[model samples]
Target: MTSILLDTPNVPALKVENLVVDFKTKNGVVNAVRGVSFSVDRGEVLAVVGESGSGKTITSLTTMALLPSTARTAGVVEVDGHDVLNASEADMDSKRGNVVSMVFQEPMTALNPSMKVGKQVAEAILNHRGLSKAEAMARAVELLDRVGIPDPAVKARNFPHQLSGGQRQRVVIAIALACDPTLIIADEPTTALDVTVQAEILELLRNLVKETNTALLLITHNMGVVADLSDRVVVMNAGKVIETGTTVQVLTEPAEPYTQALLAAVPTLPEAQWDAIFAEERTGEPRHAEPAGNSPLVDPVLDMREVCVDYTSGGRKLRAVNQAGLVINRGEIVGLVGESGSGKSTLGRAPLGLVPVTGGEITLFGGNVLKASTREIRKLRSRIGIIFQDPGGSLDPRMTVGDSIAEPLVMHGVNGKRPGRAERDARVRELLEAVRLPAANANRYPHELSGGQRQRIGLARALALAPELLIADEPTSALDVSVQDEVLTLLLDLQKEHGFGCLFISHDLAVVHSVSQRVTVMQHGNVIESGLSSKVLQRPEAPYTRHLLASVPSPNPIVQRQRREARTALLLSSGTRGS
Candidate 1:
């Protein structure tokens, strides 16, 4: 039941012809999708690839006939032979979950938080089918199991919040498949997951297409996921399809310059390239920069020995972080890499005392973090800064960006005297300029800025104190590929400018490789491997690290497809043996 060569479907699972969508905004008429035409056949995966504001999402919405009143759309959209372009509201609603379905990017948003997961899946079945409550519930449990949920019956009763991110996504898939849809639109399905969870979800989608002959219209910006999953690709840019071809044709030999640039933005595992990074001359000398430089013998800005974090959950002692040791010398960046629940974040928080450490010795700026009093820790924190993954969340929406950046200076200062309005204002202006934002942007609120801008504002605020150490946790993971590259480049430049030691925590191996001088791999609360990024990325020693690397989807279409096949074969063999 694998996908066949490209061919016109007798009754195309999903089709869009000359689609045009526009919205009347406060500013002017904004064109979202313009003359976008494509078709997805049964059992085939057609990926609509583009970055933010590229009309990839608008085209999908047009097919579902889900635009708001402000939207003006002209198109021929067909779903399983239904004329979706002109279908009535009632007709569209009736056909939505039955004939066509959608798997949203964030499962938490898609699902009802108050309801049990089983009932959510059952609701879809009850929507289209004339099944009794008991029957629908039974069908829901079956679907959960079919989608690879362990203890499906038990899990069905749990609320969405009780499930892990990966599990919640699986429930979403089960809901989408409940009615046996002819077409499924998956919008950035794996963007929120780790590489390992992403691999599982992709495999599930591929198997679903094979088992049920369902067409998948995957809308995403991830080129690696596109190369690994798609049979054909439609490259969209500025509300138009720039190029449309087979995956190999588009990826290996793209005819459009925009497509080439999109591919170029993708980060690669830094193998021998670390040499070039180390060779570059950096001017910013850290206050603690010893004659030994980043040498192992140099006094580290932050050091942890046998670090462990414990939590009380359900009346049981859960050790979130095992005995982990790490050191970050001045002017050097140390990467903490792992999947979700791997304790990398926990380990990163230890030096800052953000989490209660049951055991371990943490030293920051040569001061004992464990033995430090609240006042002492506060004094030590004057030299430390942290940037969270969601910068927008970290910022107060009510506060202006300028105020946010200035707040740190008011809280921590040299000689135990807080900066006055004059000093704070000057530092705020300088910090904003350092992050490449307009000085006037300081007056703007967090909501007024875009995602990338907010992230830059976050960096500006983190560096406002002129700290000697910084902890960046998944800082650029939520951004577009090109924007991610921009942020990383800016961060490295600034790190060099301040000569600050950084502990960069991320699930993205490619990102970790590009930034960190040294890399540590964590798994299940333990440090599994540690070495130079050059050595670890190129030739990983730990089996888990190798699996993590293998899970990363390559941008090469031919190579990724080959790996997918080998992986599928291994999955099948392992399943058979377990059975």
Candidate 2:
């Protein structure tokens, strides 16, 4: 019997044959997944890449039988050689954490906020392994440590809210690994993370696949991530599989047009191309944009000197920005690049006086922000337009998009006077046309619009006044690559037309490279590096800047592997953990 058992071939970790999923909506039956077929073997990584609503997520969720009640599923889902689709709820409940588990996109949402993180991991272990509370808790701590959570025994006692975003994600990974599941499905696990943190999570997932021989199903829109870890690639579009091949074949020599388009949409840093860009951007205009010649002496649109911003957290004074200096020339876009808590956003907000800086000078339109009175500051703010990261949150849900776009005009008035309704309406329509949104969409609510559409509304609202300076804070971070490209192109076009100097705040280097004439690197509340995009980006001076650049995964598998080899050593030696 032992010889027979040893001789038996290993069953695939997960297999889905001709899967179909449809959601019963008020409009109609929406097909989420149509005849999707794939399998993940032990110690192998399968990546599902596609844009939003491409059924990549739906197919992964079906394996664990976690779809909503309004959805209908059909197909064979086998986990550990056992049928999952036809299994009883009781059987699925028993098998879920034991045979398969999932890591969610948002770690905070995945974890129980009220419970201690360690207990959360222990609970998963206790449910499947039938271990005592103490044993499960002990194992949970061990698992956390294995996943690189420092001082796991102590951290396990802390609530989820106490940990950083990356730490919270690590905790989530620990829960998934607690039961020694044969397969782990990570759905956009690193989507909301910084490049450095994303690199760490990818490393953790890759190590687990190798050390524990676990099958990994990674579903993401990030092609860079696909090249970094996936062994085989599956490209999905409109609920169907458009392409499939090894990672190298799919990324480098994509056979399908859709796959090719998807790969092309990804932003890349071409080092050689950046070398030719203008190095002294303060004196010259952007290559694509002409000088507006607004000021007599051509004063900077926005300038910061020794700017300091502080926030009180947990009874301790925290410096969010420190002595940050930057200058945005007229018709120029200066990119502020940094990880979370690196003070990019804080510094961006300083010009608007939204976050009061504790010290330093902010010159807006050549006026000092530090010495300006509240009335003066308010007046100066009229020349500044702001775009937030979350388009939905930024827009008022109670009003139509038209009303939202005209809100700044309502508050500040048009042409230094209280504008009539007709004027506001015409301006609203003009702005709608400018953003490429139909005038009819003015009647739509924020919730009714798609993510990309809503962001366009944000643009219309920000540019309603056509301010001299614009603050675009991570405007394209939440969008798909294709949509991101569209939004960016439109933003640049508008910037050129309006001749507004822009502070483009984002963590993405490739995006900054494409858009900004100059770039600044931030870390731990300090301005680590700053220069022209040509010099700072291609030939970074600071070690941290190079690390940040290296942390970004390449879409090419071979190049990413080479980058990984060098970056792994740097990260290990420096012990850098992203905020």
Candidate 3:
């Protein structure tokens, strides 16, 4: 093993002493981060977790000296013995991507889309190490290979859009690890990936940390991640550190209520497991929508009949979604659960006329969505809102949060056919406040807001026109669990009050279980199962469905504790017998 040592003989790789970051806005100085302090040792992964507006990202950015010029920062941030909080521009510039590098939550935006990924990575090497173009490009290819990209040479030449989300993230990591930095900060690294990919990324990071002896500052809200990867954890709330402890201590014996709540929020079962259960559950005790009652059953806002989505890649025809059929009754929250590439997204998008159906028909509220005219579709779109998985990407960086929320309402001519500017501003503020965000946040850009806040804003935007059918495509997938719970609860309450149909798509069974009344399982574009959430999850019949259910990591602490104890007992008993 290569013995990689930290910079200081005894001091930790990173130490923060009373870090404070404040943003001066139109209203008042928003204390984005207040009096935070922590230390990360070499080979240690320290997770800083909190909801949106909790200052997790701000704290790290301030520590890295990557904060904007207007932001006022006061604190002592020392990384590898260098005092970074007060470091001069020249000093910071030299150490920025060399001694310390950061991999942002969205690698697509972080990386230059116009340039080749290899060339961009090579630029970092050339700027920091004075390497020639040929040498840097060669190093870039090697770095790509090191990050586990198959056919590194070709991959290195490809642009960001040409790669998968997982591959793009890996490339970003490769860039961060290029100079062998002592400290690497990853902010919500696995936000948008599927479970299997998430597991692989986490494992890869763990292995990289071990191989390089790198100190990692992981900023996220996912408790599952903290449990799986973090050696130590710092829980943040409203710019302050509420609690800090080892992963086990924080996860199992949290001292703070916020910490405890955060842990309770992550989805339990993997998507594959849930998909299998969904298919099998259909085979046994299938649930049909209750017949029309005293109150006439509302017509389905969106209905699918034998819908099939297909794609041809590498000269192979791939049936992404097979003859899938489902109905979204008016005001019903229909949960669609499946693994990656299982056709949940395909079905969701089919209603919006975004994805074409190959073999079946899709109708919207007695009208054929596939046959809807451009003008008709545009009119229909006003009443059907979609909130995507990544809120940041869905939002425009150039537009203010208030403007983004108002755009839909303005386009739809809400409140007396395009109300006055003052009225629209008031509506924006009200929407922001309704989402539990401070009204002052309306003036800020998407980049100024936290991930959770951005998602809330995205929801607010979706709700702007008060659409009858709200299609949320993995809306909470990118958010931290605590924030995710809040969003989920918000969605549930919104549905209850507004009485709008919600076609909620997700890969997480536990999350789907929380909000959705009925569940639909799709695999390779075919509807394998459809039933009451309880029936589908509790006693699934299909082998695939059972496997999916089994994939749910056991959340019962007692079970885990007992298993560990039993293993210990067995080992001791065997040792005694041998002796």
Question: What would the TM-scores of all predictions be?
Answer: 0.91, 0.93, 0.73
Candidate 1 accuracy as TM-score: 0.91
- Alpha-carbon RMSD of each model: 6.7, 5.2, 7.9
Could you give candidate 1's per-residue lDDT for residues 478-508 as a string of tens digits? Answer: 8999888889999999999889999999999
Candidate 1 has which clashing residue pairs, if any? none
Q: What does candidate 2's lDDT look like per residue over 117-224, in tens digits?
A: 999999998888768999999999999999999899999999999999999999999999988888899999999999988999999999999999889999999988
Q: lDDT tens string, model 3, 239-274? A: 999999887777788899877776777656422333
Q: Which candidate is the best by TM-score?
A: 2
Q: Which model, 2 or 3, shows the larger lDDT?
A: 2
* Cα lDDT, model 1, residue 165: 97
Q: Model 1: residues >4 Å from true position, as ranges?
A: 1-9, 270-295, 414-416, 562-579
lDDT of 3 at 133: 94
